[model samples]
Target: MSANAEDKLVIMNEEELKRKQREKLKKLQATGGNPRPARTLFLFNLKNPFRKACTSIVEWKTFKIIILLTIFANCIALAVFLPMPEEDSNNTNINLESLEYIFLIIFTLECFLKIVAYGLVFHEGAYLRNCWNILDFVIVFMGLFTFALDTINKIAGVPPPAPAVAARVTSQPDPAVRRKRRPIPLIPSVREADSEV
Candidate 1:
């Protein structure tokens, strides 16, 4: 063969070899051949039953975490507003109010997004039947109650009462207001009635 033809043939063979190598690498990758050892705990396969159970419990979705965080925020707000001597100060009250307001806004937005993503039927409890759905409804309702209470208190020239305090004060029934029983009147006998007449 001519030197020029030989050089061209060598170049073509080299290109073909490179192409084959690339294809072989791709096939190995596709099959996960020669995988690197798992470096982290997450990559390791679960062998212990307890560890597997724990992993299953902790492997929650992003939406589930958001719901849990929303619930936790509201619970913290509730704890802040509880009728304790430590929380009765004006500064603490204001702080708690602001925290509650922020949590409510976040929860409201979260509910809106859930409704938009899942549609009205799903948001209204068409699918899931669990504690998360119940908590979502409660948080939304509590947010609305807080807004309404704030408006009413603003209009009435009074400070807004915390829900914990309001619930405690209203839930107690007065012990002094028990109804008295009326005495049954005895019927007079006929002879006694005649003598009286």
Candidate 2:
């Protein structure tokens, strides 16, 4: 756009805007304003349930650390569950699955904290606006999916095989089972049996 058109669009001329701001700052300083107030700890108040928490750089760092720890918890649970053998995974896997649920719960809570902290819409950078926040939200949903699958497995008494694995392959009975319940033959030689024992 031409400078003439842009100039027309501006509601306040730059000089006038600057002058107004200076006057406002002067008034604030007259009332003992420090221009920049010292940062304070964010005390959560239960009365104002929707109020955002610590907005300063330092408090944001603390929130980031909490997020990182939750990620680490997710990684640990995944490490425990993913490589486990199917035979052993059924019974023992429940424990790791429970651990994942704990992480999932924490992630859900973090999402809530972010919502209450930043708000759902624009203020500066909104919670859902940033890509990292979106990623975090996605991870939380994926964790929920895993928890649901685990719950279903617990209810069914068996985990479903992967789609790539045919049902028939895993459905086959154990190889050790024999049709005949053959009687054990007595040892032919007592001395050899004693030596083997």
Q: Which structure among the candidates has the greatest lDDT?
A: 2
* C-alpha positional error of residue 197 in candidate 2 after TM-score superposition, expressed in Å: 50
User: Among all windows of ten consecutive residues in candidate 2, which has the lowest summed lDDT?
Assistant: 34-43
* lDDT by residue (tens digit), candidate 2, 23-119: 9798657535633222212433323434423234214776779778878877776776754443445755787766766777877887766655554
Task: Name the top TM-score candidate.
Answer: 2
TM-score of 1: 0.39
TM-score against truth, every candidate: 0.39, 0.48
Candidate 1 residue-wise lDDT, 1-197, digit = tens: 69999999999999999999998787657536522211113333324454344334334476569768877877777777745542366777778877877777777766554433333343223213346745776768887997898798899999655676667767765454432344456899999999999
Q: Which pairs, if any, clash in model 1?
A: none
Global lDDT of each candidate:
0.60, 0.63
